[model samples]
Target: MIVRIMGEGQVELDDAHLAELNTLDDELLTAVESGDEEGFRRTLGALLDGVRRLGRPLPDATLEPSGLILPAADATLDEVRKMLHDDGLIPG
Candidate 1:
């Protein structure tokens, strides 16, 4: 799988790594939904450690701007369309 970070470069992950990442994401989300703080923390920590060992930076931990200027949500549809087309993303 090719994982692309907005500001950072993309990563190519093999099947095994992708599966582990999916399992970790599922476990973390399950823990959150069940209100299991300890489980969530443990699972998150393990996920971080595992990804760190893979030598790639962790995903964005916050929603801060990536220094790339993006169109505002209220922009006209045509404007948004142009931006998406320029960015190689298409509305589905």
Candidate 2:
């Protein structure tokens, strides 16, 4: 699946990585729900880091459609909370 970071280009990630990402997604959800800025930042960073670790970055010119859209690292709690789905940012 191709995932897009709001301020960055898209990266092609395999479905095999979805489970791990979902675990991080849960942390994000908890942070959002609890209105914890630091937790949100930490969890969001972990999620993005995991994505980068498991997927290669795409060139800026790449135009493939994205299956998932992640928030930017500097995203505010409200912004991220609004982006949440039933399964968090990246659904498992």
Q: Give lDDT for model 2.
A: 0.90
Candidate 2 lDDT by residue in tens digits, 1-92: 99998888888899999998899899999999999999999999999999988998898988899999999989999999889987788766
TM-score top scorer: 2
| Cα lDDT tens digits for candidate 1, 1-92 | 34433344433334456456556656655665566767766765665455445534435553433322223323333443344432122111
Name the regions of candidate 1 deviating beyond 4 angstroms.
1-16, 57-92
Candidate 1, position 9, lDDT: 41
Q: Let me know the TM-score candidate 1 reaches against the reference structure.
A: 0.45
What's model 2's lDDT at 37?
92
Count clashing residue pairs per candidate: 0, 0
